[model samples]
Target: IPILMGLFAAGGTIYGMAEESLPFYTLLVPVMMAARFDPVVAAATVLLGAGIGTLGSTINPFATVIAANAAGIPFTDGILLRLAILAIGWLICVAYVMRYARKVRADQSQSIVYDQYESNKKHFLGDHDETQTLAFTTTRKVILGIFAAAFAVMIYGVSSLGWWMAEISAVFLGAAIIIGLIARMSEEEITTSFIDGARDLLGVALIIGIARGIVVIMDKGMITDTILNSAEGMVTGLSSFVFINVMYWLEVLLSFLVPSSSGLAVLTMPIMAPLADFANVGRELVVTAYQSASGVVNLVTPTSGVVMGGLAIARVPYVKWIKWVAPLLGILTIMIMVMLSVGVML
Candidate 1:
């Protein structure tokens, strides 16, 4: 459990790595069930791991670069601060998951899905003999090397080579083919697997579309700016400390209404940036507050495709997720508040 959580936490550190959370949730759910855990643990693991990385994203282009650009600040400014956020957030997530995992492992009745354990085991474990020892063949080792090498290349590409989603996608496609071939999968088998995987995730795609459509409605209604303008007016004459906290919570509230980090950046930065000057807060702090608040909110917001879609895949209801995640979310919120307050002082 520690090793698994640590691996997922590391995955969160890289900028675009957390995008795999939805798919990883699907894969991890069965594995958790097979290991005598509730599927909710798998679902929570996905969001907490990826979401914390995003909340503390120091260098992720999607979360940090666009936000910095929108605020007209140097992208590298406050990087240390962001890294601090990442470190603290990652530790909190690991601790939370570890504590819950220990409880569930000690007593299966403690699991939310205890009633479904028998049926879940039947479905996920199948007829495979648990006692059989499988050999790690030379071919399998080579395949593992290929898999690791692909991600190493991807990390280098993104960190140093200015690669974005398109380049990363191409690399993944190439890696998929190489891995499949090395695993002795036939062409038809590869195609079938891809289709099946996509089919299972089709709802996630649709949910994302629907979430974006909500943004479209707000955009067409022409009320996004009004909300921003009203927010600015309401916060006028606040001191720097109060202003930063208000801005952080305002971003949290807006996250429910906007949800998309980049979209919120484009919408709020122009107003928030200049407002930061009047409020005597650094524009960098404003961007920090925006990204931190939005990223944290994504873990629980119903409007977030990642949140709802992942919950759906895990078969965990939205209310149940909120109940499970609320305590952790509260801890994270307090952490973000401290980070922002400190950012304002610095």
Candidate 2:
């Protein structure tokens, strides 16, 4: 109530992030324990943030709700389909990423001198800290506690309340009450942190603006119609498995532009509904394809506002994330498509 009225926007191509406090900060904060420049930690951070964000994004307006409605399904009814799609996407992503990360380590052969997770575990068991020892004062503990509690509450708020306004609002309010007393912060100083924090998000805000542009442009151009039309033509006389493959490939390519689950479904439904009926493919199966492609494509797309937003928030450059994540995404996409083919045949 004190700040923004709500957290998520209905159709933002980019800035429309969800309100989960736990997952959002969890992905980035692991960095504090990593070596200042460790690539493993960086990769892990990218994976966690983008993965959780997408999973949660299922309920997100653009990613799931709006498109579901447009797809001729009730908004809440698509939740199961979205979950199935997200699971398949994550499975492929994690399997390939683990290998890609190993290759990065194998190729570089650098010592895991500052593995953040390992370091944190050690610290919990009485390991000696070098540089950060002096920095981990009572104030830091209080601030961390505040952040943690705020995150916990906000996570609940997201699953229940379904808006970013409450979560973000909670953060500022918690920070003032907790960090303020611990640091004996003046009202001026606490207010300053809020300003600085919001300012830090300018880059993410910009990316959101661009994502909106892409959705609007693609939608205005009627791209989805062309995609579904092509799918219909390709599978006109194909067998069950081939038909599934045709639609799968179509989605893999379309996902590059229509990363939002809802957007893709909206673009797909008018065409897919008739095609599914014609082919005797169940509506649920067609939904499976939509969900699967939606998850896998965004993981690698440079246009993905969520992925880009994570990088921006972490102060990581876009090219760096893309460079490391591309190979992983490629392998994952292939695996997901192949698996979905098997499922469709069954």
**Each candidate structure's count of clashing pairs:** 0, 3
Best by TM-score: 1
How well is each residue in 1-346 modelled by candidate 2, as lDDT tens digits?
1011112211111222432322354344344333333333443444443453453345665555554555566556545444554455455445544554455445433324333335443532235455554568877887788777776666556545664765567665765667777888788887887687668677677986797688778778987566666766876766666666677677778888777666677777567645665666655455556655665566556666665665555445566666666776666556656665656565
True lDDT of residue 45, candidate 1: 78
Residue-level lDDT tens digits of model 1 in 217-336: 877897776788789887788999999899988898888888877788888888888888988888888888988998889888877777878887777777877888899889988998
**Per-model TM values vs. the true structure:** 0.84, 0.69
Native-structure RMSD, model 2: 7.9
Look at candidate 1 and tell me the lDDT of residue 36: 63
Each candidate: RMSD: 3.1, 7.9
- Candidate 1: how many backbone clashes? 0
Instruction: List candidate 1 segments past 4 Å from native.
Output: 1-18, 142-195
- The models' CA-based lDDT, in order, is 0.79, 0.55
Error of 1 at 209 (Å): 3.0
Q: How much does candidate 1 score in TM-score?
A: 0.84
